[model samples]
Target chain A: MAWYFSGDKAVYLQIMEEIQLRIISGFYPLGTRIPSVRDLAEEARVNPNTMQKALTELERSELVVSQRTAGKFVTCDEKRVTEIRERMSSECMEEFLSRMKKLGFTEKEASEKIGQHCAKNETDPRN
Target chain B: MNEILVCSDLCKNYGQKTALSHLELTLERGKIIGLLGPNGSGKTTLIKLIAGLLVPTYGSLTVGGNRIGVETKKIVSYLPERTYIPEWMKVKDILDFFEDFYSDFSRDRAVEMLTSLNIAVGDKIKTMSKGTKEKVQLILVMSREAELYLLDEPIAGVDPAARDYILRTIITNYNENASIIISTHLITDIEPVLDDVVMIQNGTLRIHASVDEIREKNQMSVDALFREVFRC
Candidate 1:
């Protein structure tokens, strides 16, 4: 997948966010090895040192584990993955609600609008 | 602590005009440094000094801990802003010349890069387009296993596709034991590829900081910062 940077934040931080998103979305499946720093840098059009820094941060957060000669793999811990997914979901919801609030909608009103939109889009939707 | 290049009180002059004045700079190994400035801000003069093409009027500069001379020249690979190949020479002839001139020149790496770009060995310099000639020059420079790479305006005057190719070549060829200094005014295009930026203004060093640190402090891209710093 092609990566686009916003240029306002540090490139390494943005790389970390993108890699985290890939892991949560299963684009880089759990327990699967990820691309090397050089390959990822080429794909993202960034410096390899920046890519290495991002991956090192990922390792610190326990989202990835490096096995020396075997390279790095996405965390196989289902609990940790679910926790990150929940955190991401809350962040998206909060951002959506905040934007809606700016347009004169309350939190409840925003929730109802999202439910209606999901009902229209998904074949089987919860009430 | 492994600094590959060091310059102390470096100054250069052209007749009565000062091109660079008392420039003190140290470059560590394995970094991609952006030598940035506006038109005639002494970027070219500083690079020429490092490349040993021009002598500094004052102070001292060293490459790989040795003074700029035959020993340092053997380890420093440079690409000037202009293409220097004779028009009648074929690609193979140029490759042969470099291979014979520098002990660290890699013929295999040069051939592989040329083949990948579809640059035939038999193609004469006169037959290639301007962009192609620049690419050939870059390929020849990067094919060396040198301690330092001084690329003067390597990405200027090229299409976006060609720019991407050049950046990729630089990224992939980068070794931990060497460093690359890419001099250009196109900050936005090469900002992400650079580890640090050395900004020069009015024949003096303005700022020399890491790319991420610049973004974090200014809350903007290096290109935007450059515009603000050099605003007319």
Candidate 2:
């Protein structure tokens, strides 16, 4: 899975967003062992402490679990992960739809466009 | 308990140039204080004096009714503007060093955080980038359960995205009863979290008041007032 950093926000929050994206995209499957903080910090070119803050935020949301000697791993609870994923997706979709409507797109038109985009992606050889 | 910080006629000088001139201020507990000033305005000097890193040329600075010394140092967790950690040490080693020196440091919490960030304990600091190094420094300072936190330009060098995380960590991790004094010129970025502000100009106290009072009295953001006051 690819890692992404965002501008105009906290690094820790961006890190959390990236992790959430991975979880949602199924790159980090349920029960998968996540990299250590130092490893992630090195890869992301962020301070380990900043990385730690992101992880703490994730753990607070119950998206990841930590064990003393074994290190941190993605939460194994499929139902919880699904719930989080759906909730985030719905929130994003709502925001996107509202923005599109504000920009003069009708609800039906927005839906049709999204459907076409998804269908095209599904049939594309790149998929 | 009643007074978090007390500085009376604090003065500092470098040769003929005076950095701080008879500055007196009192800081109370459970407040987030912004130490604001232009470049070379003695913001760092005042913080260093209060932190016990630099001695005053005149007057006395005290915390919890004690003079600035080793005793006061124990309760203060300081994050300097520049890198303090050696580049050769591993992340784990840094944690160990903090654990050994600072009794209030939380090693478990630090490790757990690192794990979530995907940072390995064994990785050397030399391999990490500058932004990451700053984050590591911030984490160590934040993890301490100290009574006073002196942060010198905590978000000065980082990208905008990382600035939010640093601010968030400061908001979330700080001790409720402790006082935090942050020195910065990035006034707009930190204006939301500040409870009180102390502004300096030419090594003298210019503005010292609660954020609400300043906003109400001036009808402008701290950043705006800062620009107006220190207009070049």
Best-fitting candidate, scored by lDDT: 1
* Residue B111 in candidate 1, Cα distance off native in Å: 0.5
Q: Write the per-residue lDDT of candidate 2 for residues A68-103, one digit (tens) a residue.
A: 989999999888888888998898999989998998
Give me the TM-scores for chain A across all models, comma-separated. Answer: 0.91, 0.82
How does residue B13 of candidate 1 score in lDDT? 93
Q: For candidate 2, what is the lDDT?
A: 0.84
- Which lDDT tens digits does candidate 1 get at residues A11-49? 899999899999999999999999988899888888889
Provide the overall lDDT of each model, using Cα atoms, as 2-decimal numbers: 0.92, 0.84
- Which residue pairs come into collision in candidate 1? none
lDDT of 2 by residue, B40-124 (tens): 9999998898788888999988998889888888999999998888887999899999999999999987776667667789988
B10-61 in candidate 1: lDDT tens per residue? 9999999999999999999989899999999999999999999999999999
